[model samples]
Target: MSAEIPAWLALESGLVMQGRAVGAEGEKGGDLVFNTAMSGYHEILTDPSYAGQVVLMTYPQIGNYGVVDEDAESARAWPEAFVMREMSSIHSNHRATSSLPAWLKEQGIVAIDGIDTRELTKHVRERGSLRCVVSTTDGDTTSLVAKAKATPSTDGRDLASVVTTGAPYTWAEGYHESYPHELGRAFDGAGTKGGGERIRVVAYDFGIKRNILRSLVHCGFDVTVVPAGTPADDALAHDPQAIFLSNGPGDPAAVSSGIAAVSDLIGKRPIFGICLGHQILSIVLGAKTSKMPFGHHGANHPVRDLQTGKIEITSQNHSFAVETDSLPDHLELTHLNLNDHTVEGMRHKTEKVMSVQYHPEAAPGPLDAGHLFSRFREFVAG
Candidate 1:
């Protein structure tokens, strides 16, 4: 590997850290947040929900498995920068097409390694997410701190519009499995319908993940992905049997168009949402959202399913959550986060509407909540 260059990071709180640069030799600033997942660094780096933020991995060692195109959650990496304790120099995965640092440079992602990630994670845990700057081209801590503080805040920003797809498209791929037809759902090995019938769904692409589309297809839905700003009439023009709201970045309240569209779409057909989508749905149903001290960004969050009285280990990556007390009478809390007592899942009392704050697709995580897709299928069919 080439010799690592010097890099410096400065939080708006005036905290400074010195490390070695591994990715692009440039400067960048964003909201500094940490993720606790032990793996899936590639997916985390590419997740559009991380837009406008600098990601610091809590896991001590990252990039052990290297980078592969098939593992990317989106077409490109979205984080403003990547930080870690030790980015492995020697990646050993058989599927790796390129080393982590090499790919990050190629993608123009500014990154730093060999730092006290533990201290950084603890700081964020106690003080909430902070604005920060990472620079390999500059070493002045005072200047970096000022730049960090001057970085634009994600609040009241419509980032969903920034990351959403440019046009509508159809998705038909599913989970690549050894035996596709033998899974829970009856399928003809192609993720379509075996009996020549399939539920048609229109999914709002609020910076959606590819795995989610694959999961929907695996559950037997023909998905049509539309842009985030698509109006209610335009989405309904697809004549969908159900509507799906996808996860995204930034303040949910700022996604005004999405909330308006969802408000008009409610009760017309079955609807399901995930992550930011859940927050948007709750807002339309008379609830409110607030940013968490340190948002849930991990694979091992434990949640309780109120309807089943079962605990599920879920994967979550959101900085805002629905306010429990603000929920309207028309909606029922379906799941709760065991750790923080926050709302994780909810459903309409009378309509075919439900949503979860965690990712059920489980990309690079556990399979505990994957059944929610089938539940949505049953919900649409009913």
Candidate 2:
């Protein structure tokens, strides 16, 4: 808690930056990545897709509004470490039950404030995401760099399996009407207005977020969350009308189980995928996936719907992308990222299967893409 305590961050490329330290002590490291979102620090921290990654906030100041219970995307923080230009000393929101510093410490996440994040983000953008180390106990640049270099990269890693739910369960919670709107463990709805003839959906929990489940429930789907490697027969045993693949961390190409499982599930029922799910679906659709030079991780990414030519401001987070050349004839591309002209959404021409490479349930982001969930429901109804 004193400014006298030294902290240092070291990149695999031999770049080192000094800063003030907070949260859990000792050294922590992960695949260094940056987010451009101005807010949603809590949601970003809790998102399971950030597992095994060190996240740097592009926004100058963080923790100004503090952390609230409603905004977490998962049960616990998943980022190995957190970096910020300035961490607020005081948390002042009326609804905030937790201070960012105490919360990070409690979660066992190493955090550094006052780091030169601008230069670090620029480095990642230009050189691509590199392994990095954040040390609060040891400040020796040489040792930190060595540790950073020793850290394995996210490439070929199946991080989703590590963060996935150990057992299958039903999710009935719906939209959060709270002040901050983060999905809480409690269901506070008063009536059954969100209820109806619930369409049964088998959701593949590839590090799924709570908001995605909330969105599914809001759309009247009775969701059964299964593990990342759940096969078609096990899922079909529940007699679900639809199948869903969730967003997650790491390379989609490495998930041979997911790809194989999805390949068998397609055409059997209506299916939908998001982020890593999208990439896996693409792989099963005879497409290839490769790591992006600098992956998209932000609240505001523009994607154009091919069918309507309308632009949607979306929240995105992923390191791998679908190769345009790898798409098969049966798959029809539906959305494209306006910034990089990359694939965003696609669907099988014949089967009731569709996927998006961005988060439509956007827990910490916009409502522009929410209609995609409705479309999926319609797809299932048909």
Candidate 2, number of clashes: 2
lDDT of 1 by residue, 1-382 (tens): 4666999999999999999999998999888888899998998988899999999999999988899888778899999999999999689988889999999999999999988999998888888879999999889878988999999868888899999999999999877653233343522232354443678999999989998988888778899999999999999999999999999999999999999999999999899999999999999999999988878999999999999999989999998899999999899999999999999999999999999999988667877787888888878888
Q: For candidate 1, what is the TM-score?
A: 0.96
Which residue pairs collide in model 2, if any? Answer: 70-182, 71-182
Q: Write the per-residue lDDT of candidate 2 for residues 242-336, one digit (tens) a residue.
A: 99999999888888788888889988989999999999999888899998887899999999999999998999998889988789899999999
Model 1: pairs clashing at backbone N, Cα or C within 3 Å: none
lDDT of 1 at 303: 98
Name the 10 consecutive residues with the lowest summed lDDT in model 1.
179-188
Candidate 1's error at 8, in angstroms? 0.8
Per-residue error (Å), model 1, residue 230: 0.1
